[model samples]
Target: MSQYVEQGYTAFADHYGSSEIIFGQFRRSRQNTQRIVGATKWCVFRPTNPTRVVVEAAVQERLDRMQTDCIDLLQFHWQDYNDKGYLTALRHLQDLQQEGRITTLGLCNFDAIRTDEICCQLGPGSIVSNQVQFSLIDTRPLHGMADVCQRHNVRLLTYGTLCGGFLADQWLGQPEPDAYSGRLTPSQRKYLDMIVKAWGDWTLFQSLLVVLRQIGDRHGGVSIANVATRWVLDYPCVGAVIIGARLGVSEHRGDNSRVFTFQLTQEDNAAIDAVLEQSNGRHLITAIGDCGAEYR
Candidate 1:
């Protein structure tokens, strides 16, 4: 984010995990977002503990460090699905909203099943969005995630749309990743390797890249990353794709922005699937594991 600030892009960081764990450079990040993005807040996470006061005070302490009167986006990072209290958290969040401390509410890493439960439990207010992984490589959200958001009137803010920078021109025609390319963590590499196999092997991915290159040609130049993002945008209720900013590295501001310019044709969409449909079904839900579960 410091590098993002240097590059003059508005830098807002999402804070997740337990209240006791520090997520980001809270104070400085808040100041930077405010300066660059017009009004911004340091995002705060919901706690695992059921004590409403502890969670409320934790959020308040984050607000105090941010030097902001209100948080712009506060998200429950995950639902305690088998827990003693989900409403206990929501009631306090509703309280915070009524108190004007939190301007917007969101959920992260939650699937459609739990989203329905949240809507049924709390019946809605201030829930502007839900964050999920939606990429060509990971299509679990399309199965039911999109439908639930439509029902609840909640939007999806996505991550992993670019698959940690693998969906790019740089990777096209490259050697199949070796054992030590740093392309993915060892475990993640195993998972994604299975994903590639599902997408019909290296020979087929190269063909897809050929199609992407042809499509990119029509737009003067576009990244496969853009096509991957376009696939996500086609789904209902997707508000934005939170492309990760590798903070000290150079920026792809232009590449990232071009995603909005070109539209994909039915043929283009079919071309992407032509490769995928013929392939074996590794079914990433099982191969790649659940949301945040792989990391665990």
Candidate 2:
């Protein structure tokens, strides 16, 4: 559920910085305003593979647009597995850290194997997070990522936790769209359709909704996206879920924060487990290709 726009990195960063000023306009119009959430950094992961000097300049530019003196977390967008000079990029970031320009380092869309390689090579010079997609539907990380992060002490930042709003109750009883709206990319819709089919059609999805609603009612009203995000938060090394804000289009801040409001009970967990039992794993673990596979 990550967006890859090669040309406007600087502008995008600036727009997001200024987004807070205008969020209210849209929140009132289209978004749900029941959730309370907090400040989170949106790290850009790219394979422009800029030279260290260019990257350093670009990072500075982003900081300027963001109007922030320090980036709480700066995550590299992608890695060129064959080229292997990301070490140089990490070194540059480490130098920035010494200057107090960046507070923490992170990696986006990188697999466990490459993450270990980087850690072994750099010995922890500002690295702290590894952001990747992790859904109940796509539990590939459980195959090895959890153990790797434990050993290396790297926090994993999970994105697509809500699968671009496809994992919500809105779709439960509704007729399938000729194509889904509200998604910005074809890839996003593609995954939503995948989830629909994988989750056992519209009918079974309605059943899942009944379960989520029951859980929500017990917890004082949590949305399906909130539930999915909380589930991700329960995973090992998952510091947070990276949900898209879709500035000026929707505002889920309040609903998203219900994650902190109510704790999921053993009964709740068991309830979720019960629904998952009915899951048919037809589309479960095939490769979406690599990490951030949707973007590429």
Candidate 3:
């Protein structure tokens, strides 16, 4: 946390069960607090009603946890799309924002149509960003969500860009593991399943890795992860890509720096798009349904 903020990378932390550590870190340093952006989610696990009272309490708890006057971005997440309470919750959040309790408002895993409805209900420019699963493997956002966000001027904050580290060379040319093999971590297994289901066969994925390596070699041997991150970074409507940092456990500062060192060429884009064109099609998007369909 200290190293990253010191490196001029603005920290974005969420309030959850273990948020105390994050808040503690910032509380220890006013400078750190100033350098970080705090975001929290509502309706994490189906709040009974998501009423204004529930929304206010949740926001207040988050504020008290982070010990900040206002949250940088309050992202809302609701599992049941049919539940109308989500709009009411956002309205309360908007009221809180007016009272200076929130700096900005955002949505997490919201599909295009719903986001459009929310924008219409809130008038305009109500959402600054929509956090979503967006990557080479999960291009579902481009189907309609990207257009909706663009129409509403809502930027995209993406995740799963590295596909839980599967995009790296470490997994290139490797055989698919047995389900009970226990070789992959939970995250790796989850994203690998995405590859098998949403992406195509391992053979086609390896082809992508090969092309990424070729592009990297042209630009001074950047890692496959760097290429993956750079690819998503170049996508339209993306404001930021959330890379997980295992603070005090592991860090990728050096590898992450490569993302800024170079740019992808049109040739590189065409090569990637060619493989993508072959691996999957609108079918993948159909299977995924929409940006946040899995969660619902």
TM-score of each: 0.80, 0.75, 0.94
- lDDT digits (tens) for residues 115-222 of candidate 2: 888888878545687878787556556656677788788887776676667678776577656554653366467665755665456566567667777888787777
Better of 2 and 3 by TM-score: 3
Tell me the TM-score of model 2.
Answer: 0.75
Count of clashing residue pairs in every prediction: 0, 7, 0
The digit string of per-residue lDDT tens for model 3 on 122-150 reads 97878998999888888888888879877
Worst 10 residues of 2 by lDDT: 1-10
Candidate 3, after superposition: displacement of residue 186 in Å?
1.2
Residue pairs in collision within model 2: 34-254, 35-253, 35-254, 35-255, 36-254, 45-77, 46-77
Model 1, position 189: C-alpha lDDT score: 70
Model 3, which residues run further than 4 Å from truth?
Answer: 30-34
For candidate 3, the TM-score is 0.94
Per-residue lDDT of 46-117 in model 1, one digit per residue for the tens? 436657786688578667655666776776754445663655776687788789988777777766777777
Q: How far is candidate 2 from the true structure (C-alpha RMSD, Å)?
A: 7.7
- State the number of backbone clashes in model 3: 0
TM-score of 1: 0.80
Model 2 regions lying over 4 Å from their true place: 1-50, 180-188, 197-200, 277-285
Cα-based lDDT at residue 98, candidate 1: 80
Against the reference, the lDDT scores of all candidates come to 0.66, 0.63, 0.82
